[model samples]
Target chain A: MSARDAVLGAVKAALGRSRPADPADPAAVAAEALALLADPDAVRPALPGTDAAVAFAARVVSPKVGATLDRVEALADLPGAVRRYLDGQGLPHLLALQPDPALQGLDWAGFELRDAALPDEAAAFGLARWGIAETGSLVFHSGPDTAVLGHFLPLHHIAAVRASTILPHLEDYAAVCGAAPRNANLITGASGTTDIEGSYVRGAHGPRFLHVLLVAD
Target chain B: MGTVFKRDVARALSDATLKTAIDRTTVTAERKRAAALTDYPQFAAARERGTRIKDHVVAHLDHYLLEFERNATASGATVHWAADSEEACRIVLGICRGAGARRVTRSKSMLGEEIGLPHALEAAGIERVETDLAEHIVQLAGETPSHIIWPALHKTREQVSALFKASHRDPHKTEDVEAMVESARRELRDRFLSAEVGISGANFLVADSGAVCTVTNEGNAELTTTPPRVHIVTAGIEKLVPSLAHAFVLLRLLVRSATGADLTQYTTFHCGPKRPGDLDGPQEFHIVLVDNGRSRMLADAGLREMLRCIRCGACMNHCVVYRQIGGHAYGATYPGPMGAVLTPALQGAEKARDLPHACTLNGRCQEVCPVGIPLPALLRGWRDRSWKDGLVPQSVRSGLWLWRFAAERPRLYHLGTAAAVRAMRLFRRGGWIGRMPLAGAWTRYRDFPAPAGRTFMEQLRDRERGR
Candidate 1:
């Protein structure tokens, strides 16, 4: 038997069945599993947040959030916010930007822009498709526009997400993240680890700094 | 069997470093767990939902496993199945050889450890570097992971600093934690950027969309999978949830129960190799699902609940036996109450009979268990099986037999206990027995209370006579 057959057959045997789909009086195991997939709305925890944007902003900028945030009135205002955040953190304004359309049509007179973030690059910019409020997570979908390296390679990651795209919870993103994203990253905060004897370290492997730009428009 | 474990634990008990490290992590984790649950009152409900989802998936694993394979293939990823650990190692080795991978970068994987993947790689002449900070420390020290979450937290800071200085060959080394972390980051960055293959363990597999999800606080997993030419995910068949929604529900329970965090710093899902025009991701994506005795576990209804483990390390953090002796004493891939039950089921009740007997049946592990595994009951079940299989120690078996013989005879039991109570008084020193013959092990650490002059049965009889 194929390894798949042998393995699944083992399960079938465990469940007291001879095959995946049997015509026994009891419901076939395959059919029962398919029935579960039909219903996507599983039980969700009762988190206290009715308004998505408010909860998201509060969480992203919370005192112990390990990340910084800036709320821009429009998508066009994101450049100014990023500039201000860079200036505030004493980081260089030069950034390797993901070649995304959502990032175009912006005035970039002062800042030097480059392609996908280099391994030792100080900062990188990317656009997020969705933001989750419950944990203040940014959902990055890899495609022609978004460079997966921009999410990890740089020391600082500036992710921009529209406030209107902020979902109240992670389960809500499942409905929005339909079949398009072959690769999706739900980053809750900056890369960190308490592995060294429970002492918190901000940058363990990836970006040490995660700054989220909430585009109000 | 008892002699081996007794030796291992005897060494662990005397190791001052191990005791200090265990006390720190367990106490901090328990405190954080309480605080996180307090902030989020819905944790109880989320845990219940997570357990129910796992139960449903385990019951119908055959369908979901096939569904995961089909959907993953549809997304341009290859899915391989392994009936056991050897086949799983061979498949991973074959992938690396086919890719001509000289060097590989890896995130921490419990399944990888279970299958002895590191040894396989070493034997096949492939060099692999562990990217997780804790895992990297353990690798340099040439030891298996003790704790699941804090893989190498058992080592002291001085030990970690020394390990780095020796491994990295740095002359200007200090005992500072931050400097050590920076050293690892700098040392591993080139490997992450250069490795041909990156192997990671899946935290959960979404059967609905075939997303191999990995949850980690460190960004090592992200960097490991992103820059490599090939990304191979090694996961157990039991790590499946029905959909992304169900996954989030479990994610809620996992983070809080593990480290008292609201969520993991990073939870990435890879649906396929890469999208049409992705700039930088693995060109090839493959997921190897290993059975490795999980089928045997599923077949046994009594031991089936062991499969619900999310490996958050909560049970170990709160276990009475684990706190006393720590993970290395368990002498298995997994440790603590979960390991106590799972190790025997996977290895055999006879080989690891000492495991089930290690538990004090305190029930603290199950109380803190995110998926609500009845650990005390499971430990009891293993003990019962050990007794039936004659794997229990001869002394314990005979002692129980003697108790049962007396317990069955009420008059003789009263007479025997009355005489035993009088004998116990001989060793009495003031309020407690400092020493007792043939039972010195009982008072080895703690004084045994002096028995009353008469057995309770005799006193009860006198009271009934209205004396």
Candidate 2:
């Protein structure tokens, strides 16, 4: 018999093999997928459509991290507002940054530096080239060679995004890039999950807290 | 004689504790998969799209792969191609040696497992720790993964708690899932910080950028590949796609089809090494493109489409038989309908001789395959080849021969059925047979309805004659 006949025979035999199939409703499946993606508590909810999907991904995958830094002096002397903001949130262990060139000498801890990997335990709040201003997310790439540990392994993941970097809508990103990236990452706030149960735990796979620095600068 | 393959096969088939672990985990995973698929939309769309994109990528693979390599090299990542698993392992191990890596953290990748990475790395004196929650459980248990998606799906909460207590010394101080995760995390975090190298698997290799994609519900995949100065990726050649746009399409389909998730918690992309102004990332990047048996598969027109599979477990979850026997019974790293077809083709018929016969040919796997693989047809091909090559047992051969003979002639078929019916009636009563010698197992679990005795033809004849 021809391949067509063989396929038909197989289908017939398969139909005989199982009980009646539950109907397949495609629209319901798509709606459900959109709902999951939009759900904040979802563990990487499926982004709806090709546009939302790509934008959400670009935020997580192609973050505009590693450009430049405006260091503000002593850890304590740094912006009181920034420190107090964090302190009110119950976060400590922040360090001081000085752009004196002598102290900010090495490429390792430089502000807005590109092509550097995140140190294994280091916390970084770098800027993403593109972001969802509404959600205050930083877009960047996470791979073995990119901000490897800084993306997820860090105790604190703070991403600084320029307000100008923010897209009015997620759809505008694809037009901005022209074509989709091979792999894009969109990170909104911090990485959190409740996979242990429905108990809503933070930081199962990513940073426990996501602090977004929406810098007007 | 003492190869890892032999040992793995033996361990997979006979290890009672591991078998139990795989069985329970696979069932739960299959259930979750069902729940996930049932609850999600775009599932069918994702499956269709996944099938189309993978097919497109594989169709123009040579162009896309070259393009990827060019872009990847441009971005400062070195790409290596391995003809087989050994070569891939050697390339990765050499990278470790060159980097002076004493310890390594691993994210779960079946490709790495397929190549027997841990064993090879250990031989090179590199300490490797599996950091994925499920992988950590399996590693601590010293077992291989049963389900591709949920590697530790076999373990129950109570079992994990017990394992946690026995495995860790400071268990009393922390007694919850968070604590258990924290302990594993804290321990692995130290390894990530100290290790000079990170090893991982790629979900999709973009041909346009020469980038490797790793999708995870957990962050360990990112941590394992990053942080270390030297990063190595061991991936199957079939994973390559044309571009990042295509990558998204596949990713969209993968999670939705595999676990019914819109997206995994972490979907990260790595282009190459750290750029000039980068703060953290590997100093170097190496990708090992493993052919193993895939190139051979591509040549076989019938089996070529199998390469398009994205390793989603949708088919396995929908399979009635797979749900019952679980993955261990399939006796390979890949289990279920996909495993039945892939193992024999990749490993050879003699090595995986039992796989083809193990299936009931239900074809449910084909219905749900994201890549539209004709699984049953391929399985049937394996069966025919096995028999033609004299791989079939003598008893099975004789039985088939008898069946073929009876099936060829309607008269002989009737004679056979009449005789069988008479024999069944002598032992059957109350529309049920309590037991039959060779068929005892069937009756043990279920009541066998008695045969109608009179052939349909005989009844037709009687009615016409008005006897």
Q: Pick the candidate with the highest DockQ.
A: 1
Clashes of 1: 0
**Each predicted complex: what DockQ?**
0.57, 0.12
Question: What CAPRI grade goes to candidate 2?
Answer: incorrect
Which candidate has the highest TM-score of all?
1
Reference-based TM-score of each model: 0.94, 0.75
Q: Which residue ranges in model 2 land beyond 4 Å of their true spot?
A: A1-128, A131-138, A141-148, A155-184, A188-202, A209-217, B1-46, B172-176, B425-434, B440-467
DockQ of 1: 0.57
- Candidate 1: where are CA atoms >4 Å away? A20-49, B169-174, B425-434, B445-454, B458-467
Worst 10 residues of 1 chain A by lDDT: A36-45
Clashing pairs in 1: none
